[model samples]
Target chain A: MKRFLLISLIWPGYLLAQDNARQIEMTQLLLIKNHQVLSGNKQPDGLAEHSETVLRKAERYRYQGDFDKAVPLYQQAAQLNPKRQGYIGYVHLAFLHDYSRAMQYLNAYDALTPTFDDIEGNNPVSYYRGVIYLKTNEFALAIEQLNKSIGDIERKHGSEWVNYRYYVSRARAFLATSQPQKALDDLDKAVANYKKSALAYYHRGLALVQLGRTAEAKSAFQDAQFFFGAKRVEALQAGQAVIPEDQLFPLYESEIEAAIDQLKLKP
Target chain B: MKKQGWRNGKKYALPGLFLFGFWLTTTAQPLTRDQLTGQWIGVHAELNNASLCPLSTYLDLRSDGSFYLGMVDGKAPPKVMTWAMKAGQLRLDVLTYALDLISLTNDVLRIGQDSPMLFRRFQEIAVDSTAAFQTLNGRVWETDSLRLSLFANGKLLWENCQTYEQTVHCWQLARYGTAVFLVTRGNAHTCEGDYKPLWQLTQSGKQQFRAIGWNGQAVATETFRLVRPLKLSEMPPANEFQRCANCFDGSRYSVAEPFLRRYQPMLYDIRKAFEQYYKPVVASGQSGLVQIQFAVDCDGRMGRFLVKGFDNDYQAKSFDPQLVAQLLTICRQKLPAGWRRDPLTDQQQSDIDVLLNVRLSNGTITDVFL
Candidate 1:
């Protein structure tokens, strides 16, 4: 009787403990899948059970574009569990565009997950870093980072996966450094991959003009106009254009016009 | 006493069995890594706690252990991570995270603890040739004097106005040995008669195409380019053929009518200026159509002005071209400031060709149009 009583009393409690542990584990998995940080005070089960709830709330906030509210929750989740560093880094880099904070999170992620290889070309850390450098006008550093990113992507995903934007950015950097020929080469690749972008043709025109290829420059300018006009018309028709009047016009219209004028005036 | 003890044992046994059943229900069978090597799409049930909307998500796990996770909406880039089945749990490299193996089957996979989400294995279906044909159908290819329209039903219409020949044929596009060939049969009009032509097609670039003969030589005078589609409403009236405004090279102004319509007001203003200055010239028995050629540069400035007189049938009239040019130069200087500028080519201030035709009958200004 005593043994029966003891077993009955302890069995439910043991089952309850197991259920709780399973719940925590499941919540951790959910958090991971959702790209949220796993966190919480360590329970006797060695799982941060509360972190899952925090991450869920953070994700909700992030989805709603409430970054001010979401960032704190993500930070808290990261604090509770260090494993979330990578996801937090991605959120900061991709969503918030906070380079410094993203870099910090990425560094922490690198420290924790030191064995992570970027052989799949899916990792956007280097790409994001390169973009940040480009935006900041650190052309040399931008080129270095973008080179690394492109190399990794080409090796893993083949040349097809290396998008036109990468080439355009590198070309812009080359142009800034006065490497007009290199810029032209990159612009050619960019145009080949995605011909609809007016900016590529515009830059190509600039590069051609720099090289004193007057006829080619004129053709490139005309192409830029054609593509820009087409896109402008498309945007206007779609009703998604913020500025309807400007949407049908190209960026740097005045600059291109001036360049054409200069070319015509050249003896 | 023994009966009472047995009853107590039976009571406890029921509770024990209940606990074991609960454990069995909650603890799912462990899944092997091989079982996960496929694309899986599922719903995240608790994505938004406030709303009951479940967000669809995808998990593409390759045999190489690289996995991509993304929302089904495709708004976000897929997150990449290396995954492996470790110690009966799934370990992801990036997050340094692990997922407890729940339940996995050939079709359905369930993962999570308290509220497990279910996923379905993705199966890819083969695409038929009809789908491929749809991509190339209803497009027109053109060159200087040749136009070829490909229809969805495999009908091809080739018009060569220069040769005064129109060919209607049943066409089939086939790929063999790394080359796409256009095989045509039926009443294809040639100088000789109806014939069949098997032309091997090669794409020079996105916009350009080259058709070669069976002997592997380039087809004579055959250069095909993609034709930009224009609405019927944008086409010029029956008797009026479209040509570039300022040039005599006979190149057509193929831009949409809506684009040209935007400059009507400015062209109207220029007309009024012409009437103010040249109305007297028309009134003085100099009644003829003067063709003025000018370009609006990217800076919205006018340049490269030329003028000549032509009769109603578009033949060069007997008026002195230099006199018309001199008059146009004077009028160009007096032209108004409201050229509006071509928005499309304005960034580089691309030169927009403007052609004006001023008409006069019996020394009176009759009409003006572009």
Candidate 2:
């Protein structure tokens, strides 16, 4: 079976070689340059643009740690295209761990549309900034930023319309600030918004533990364990992206189990 | 066609003539010095059937039996070498290539057997450099089609003005005879594989400059008028520009043949050797994956042991210090027994990165992936 699988993997290489055989011409240099800048795994000539093509190209360089090429391309894309600024900021905060640069881009993006909340990829720009502040341990700033994403929506359209992940993010900030009651309030709303949210149950367990509700905390942790497993299987079966809340505040299956194990030993 | 004659003695005459013709085409033919004397422009090098590395390097084969191999842009220094056709084989410097492997057809020269490099005869077009430089240097130029900024420091910014999309590159003026070619290529951060475009300057003035070459698609004349002088602060971003960026940097070494196949028995032996040396450190909260990556040179010497750990979440986490130290010690000490003095090392041409990902549960090795 292993031998067969290896052969299957290598069979495409021969097909690829046969497919790429073309008569060489001088004009094909344009095609070569286009290939290098677009779909190639090879190094690019740093031909940046303020379009989707350039943004995707910059992402490739950034992922490969080719920061010299990546930085200039990203800067150009974000500077020239106002809409791309927030997206770049989100990528910096989540994947690159470049907090300062993320803040800079996010600030610039927010300035463009001050009155309205701006969406960056799947989440709001303020939500990404809140996660960045949380990562840096600026609990107060994190909560303030989170409120702009969650509170503003809750005021206009009520809590039901807001994403459950936003509440979970704010709840994490509340927990960091030792505001257990506020954390519990947000987690409850998060649970109400999405009943099967493992993140909500996990944070609820944390808040309950903080408030000395041991039995309830244990139950919340059990619910978290059940939902976490279900979510993992669902994501695998459907090929869905790993739960987005995990990018902001990681919640592992082992962590929930560890909490349960610790609570069991507390007797 | 001669099958009936093959049964008779007369068949030998036809077969002999065919053999002679094949020999003439394959070996008897010798390439003349005059045929290869002119400048050749690089096209593309076929590394394999699937891959083509774009070539900007030109070969200037002088009539004096000497040659210069370098970039067409004149950005890099040329390498001078002596060339001669000896015994129907082409010799450049100390390297000799088989006669059958080379072909010159319609002014295009194809060289080499395994990885064929193709080059076309260059036509030197004349244009005044002084006037071109006067219009180009330290100024921003804009056209209906494109936007270009040429800095005095030899840096350039090119943009598709129609779409407001831009790219940063290095530019230089090369004088081929009386012609001034505006050469634009990748910066230091980019690889040599990046394509370099040579634009022939056709006309130039204080207000406008015209060039005919690759306009991102086909060879065409593009006219640009002066927009403004480049500010002192404007320059190509040189932050973290590595002269030669490591190709393997930030990339995981995939398990490839013949490293995995030809060395399968050796790899199995190495894995067995690890089982004997690795002593699992039993402790709580140590369950996850640990990947130990190292490089083994052609001489069977091992070095650069790097260890990375991830918890159940797959997030970057450090394993227990003692556990990590033990793994490093095994890699540094015990792993060499399987590699050092191995006969397989003799066949290797380059150093290869080896990876071992181990799954641990409570610090006990559950599985090992080579």
lDDT of 1 by residue, B62-123 (tens): 88989777543342456687777776566655443234435665566666432345555654
lDDT of 2 by residue, A1-267 (tens): 464345334432322121111112222322222222113333544443335566765765543334446666777787667777887887766555567788999988978888867887777788888888988889899999999998888899999999998888898888988999999999999999999988899899999999999999999999998887777567656754344345545565556877899888886
In angstroms, the error of model 2 at B198 is: 34
Interface RMSD of 1: 28.5
After the best TM-score superposition of candidate 1, give how far the Cα of residue A229 lies from its true spot, in angstroms.
4.7
Candidate 1 residue-wise lDDT, A222-261, digit = tens = 8877776687677656743312221112144445565678
Every candidate's lDDT:
0.55, 0.65
What DockQ does each candidate score versus the true complex, computed on alpha carbons?
0.02, 0.01
